[model samples]
Target chain A: EPEVTQTPSHQVTQMGQEVILRCVPISNHLYFYWYRQILGQKVEFLVSFYNNEISEKSEIFDDQFSVERPDGSNFTLKIRSTKLEDSAMYFCASTSYRAGNSPLHFGNGTRLTVT
Target chain B: LAKTTQPISMDSYEGQEVNITCSHNNIATNDYITWYQQFPSQGPRFIIQGYKTKVTNEVASLFIPADRKSSTLSLPRVSLSDTAVYYCLVGDDNTNAGKSTFGDGTTLTVKP
Candidate 1:
């Protein structure tokens, strides 16, 4: 089966610095999403993108966060001025159909550590 | 989206059949129940999905009653490798916009 791949499997940065997490979703998928999981915590949805625009975002997705599909296959999440709280495992997911109709394919995840 | 309630943890031995149940009292008519399994440091993997009745796949089985108020995920002859956290999510087909909320999942610990 095709898989979603993420670059920089582990990222370490000082607080207040900027970080960009990159993901390559499965080919032929129309919907893309980003989620984060703090250690020992539930996975939290941050944002969803479709048609090259944001479809929905959670309150956790603040102005400090932005997502871009700079190319047809590359989806990136940029966090401006990362805080210590931003340290978590970031996961990228993609699905061929809308939520509830199809299952999402997720990348292993990028572990981001903000000091 | 509907909120789901599932156990925080469960324990079973190898070769046992494990069933994890989730409750969704406010499930909407258009909502579907989906389950995902996550190993440590890895992303959650889709296990099964169902609206009503029973849906069985190679990995597991999902049972939804007529009311759709609750669902059960059954894994048969579980092994030590089956230990993981299982998440249950409820979402509607009409307006989710590809966003799904995950609550703290049920952690399954399989012993030898």
Candidate 2:
């Protein structure tokens, strides 16, 4: 089975610094999503991207955050200025069909630590 | 999206069958129930999904009654490795928004 892959399993950055998380979703998937889970908290949806544009985003995905599918294979999430509260495990997921109809394939996740 | 309510935690011994039930009293006609399992420090993995009746996969089985007000995830002969947090989600197929609201999942502790 194909799997989504995330780069830099763990990342550490200073507060107010810019950080980018990269992901490569399954080749055949058409929909992609980003979620974050703070320590001991429920997974929170950040944004969903399709057809090279954002379909939807949550309140947490504010002006400081952006997503780009730079190429056919790489999906990237950029935080303009990292905050201490931004520390969490960021997950990238994709599916061939819409989320409710098809199961999402997720990467191991990238743990971001903001100091 | 329909809200789901499930247990916070459960415990079972190795080699035992375990069932985690979730309640969604206000499920919509177009909603489908889905389950995902998450191991510590890892992303959540899909377990099974069902609209009605019983749906079985290699990993688990999902049983949804005619009313669709509730569902159960049955894992046969669970082992220590089966320990993980299981999430139940209800969503409609027509929604373009890809967000699936994940509530606090039921943590299953498989004891040896």
Best by DockQ: 1
Candidate 2 lDDT over B1-112, as tens digits, reads 8899999999999999999999999999998898999998899999999999999999899999999999999999999999999999888888643588899999999999
Tell me the interface RMSD of every candidate, in Å: 1.5, 1.6
Candidate lDDT values, in order:
0.92, 0.93
State the TM-score for model 1.
Answer: 0.97
Scored against the true structure, residue A97 in model 1 reaches a CA lDDT of 83
Instruction: Please list the residue runs of candidate 1 whose C-alpha ends up more than 4 Å from where it truly belongs after superposition.
Output: none
Candidate whose lDDT is highest: 2
TM-score per candidate, chains pooled: 0.97, 0.98
Give DockQ per model, in order: 0.68, 0.66
- Candidate 2 residue B4 Cα shift, in angstroms, is 0.1
